[model samples]
Target: MTLREFMVQRQPALCERWLDLLLADYGEETAANWRRERDPFANPIGHTFTTEAPRLVEAVSGDGKFDTVAAAALEAIIKIRSVQELAPSRAIAFVYMLRDVIRGELGTELARGAHATALATVDRRIERLALLAFDVYVRCREQVFRLRQDELKRSVASLLRRWHGSELPEPASEEVVHLSPPPNHAVRR
Candidate 1:
């Protein structure tokens, strides 16, 4: 599916899943506080780049003949992001759009020879930033999952202790189960 389609289809579900995971990791009171403090909706990814990128291109290009073309390319990148929430896939498209803008501004012969050299620094930076964002999401989700599992285990242990009229097992020693990652061999290369 196209990146835009994927974002539309998956964003809400992903957000909900992450929120649920957060609730599991932190107790209800703490999670509520986190939601208020973090305010995820205020900093959505898709809307971040649209107008700013084109403005940057225009500023750099000045009144040169290629300025309009470069601006157009940047605008295209922003448009792609405008359809849905910001995502890694949209970031990838933005990188490509910027590359095209640079090439178009430089002319065909010069663009062919210098395009990669011109964009290498920016491309690397974008990739690094995208990866860092994704890493944060993964780490947060894992923490949430662990919190939920611990809470459930504690509740179970408490009930068992009461039933048996004995001391509860230590939380750390409890047999808390979790979903396992798929085996490496089962994954498509």
Candidate 2:
């Protein structure tokens, strides 16, 4: 069988292995808890892993074109990691871990020359996924940093007001633009 065929046949097992490796990074107890809790509301990170990992596996092994749904899934996972304050390397390591999962699953089939082209295709697709994930990770980290910066600004402003017993005046502008729409505008159906 072709590598893609094999990958499709093995996708569920591959995704589970990928998720297991991912949860392993969280330590044994948390991993077990995540594994056991199937409810998305109760265990969102675990839910994301269970739901999205399969999409990722299918994306890698199917048409090889990473689609928007897969990108969004990657974002969901990355956003969680970014908020958790993991180092960028740790946050994005799951993407790289998929490579090992696929390699391990393929085993001797990869060593045999039968599906070398298909294997290369899968590797290339995986590389593209990793690059996309890095982009998502960088964006998420930037957002987290911006949030922290904004919080710091708010805290300092609050402290200043409490210490000085006055609210800071809003910035004065010479010309203000009103954003309200005209009252005489016609209503459209």
Candidate 3:
């Protein structure tokens, strides 16, 4: 059988194994909860894994483009991981794990050497997916940091207003706030 046909035939089992591996990274209790709960609202991570893994598998076994379906699936999973306690490496590691799932499912089929080139291509595609995941993770993290920075600025502004007991003049566009040299302290430089 052709590699694509083989992958398509095994897609369901492949996806389930992939999801199991993905959930295992979450730790025992959380993984158990995710496995037991199918409600998307109550268990979004699990939902994402179930819904997206198939799309990802389909993408891999098909024409291999970062098409809308594949991109959406990758983004959904990455968005969740970016907000969690996972480090960047851990967050994106799931993409690489898919390779193992596929290989495991293929078993002796992969060893036959007939599908070697096709399997190599699939491995490359998985690598590309992981890179896309890293981009998504970084973008999400930058957004999170910007939001925290904005909130911090607002808090500081409120504190400063309270300290002065009056409205402080707003800084002009692109203005930098500078402090006077501590009221007579020598300017060393």
Candidate 4:
């Protein structure tokens, strides 16, 4: 079989294994439920894997110019994982699972030397995907941090407003509200 055909044939198993490994840290129950639950709302993690992994595999195997699509897929995965209780390393490490799959599936063909370059190319692409995942992961984290900071600011402002009994806040309670009677009304002829 041609290299591309082999890769295509193995995509399902690759994605399944990848998802299992990715969720393994959450424990066997999470991994098992993720595999079992096909519902999008109940098992978004599994949904993302089933939905994006095939496209990613295609992008990785495409001739030239797959980076954009691959990055999109990686970013989507990162966004979902980032919201979960995941460390940054664990969040992006799923990208490496593809490398493991490729190595295992293609090892014999790669050993024949005829397809060494092809195997190397795929490996290189997987590395690039990891970098993309990291970049996306960082951006996702920054967004989360910013959202938290905004929430904190809003909560503080609300508390201060409640304490001061007005929407406008003062540095000190002694500050006077000087309402100079409307100048135009006072000057009306």
TM-score of each candidate? 0.29, 0.77, 0.78, 0.75
Q: Estimate the overall C-alpha local distance difference test score of candidate 1.
A: 0.40
| lDDT (0 to 1) per candidate | 0.40, 0.75, 0.78, 0.70
Worst 10 residues of 4 by lDDT: 180-189
Off by over 4 Å in 3: 153-189
Q: For residues 53-138, what per-residue lDDT tens digits would candidate 3 score against the true structure?
A: 99998887887554766767887888888888988999889999999998899987888676998998898888777777776787
Over 60-160, each residue of candidate 1 has an lDDT whose tens digit, in order, gives 33332233333333333333333334454543343334334444433443434543443454444434333433333343345456667677877687577
- Better candidate by lDDT, 3 or 4: 3
Clashing pairs in 2: none
Best to worst by TM-score, what's the order? 3, 2, 4, 1
Among these predicted structures, which one has the highest lDDT? 3
* Candidate 2, 1-189: lDDT as tens digits: 877888889888898889888898889999999999989999999998899888888887887455676777777788788777578888888898888998898787787666778877877777777887777777666665656666666667867677767665432221222211232321111
Pick by TM-score: 2 or 4, better one:
2
Better of 1 and 4 by lDDT: 4
> Over 4 Å off in model 1, which ranges?
1-118, 156-189
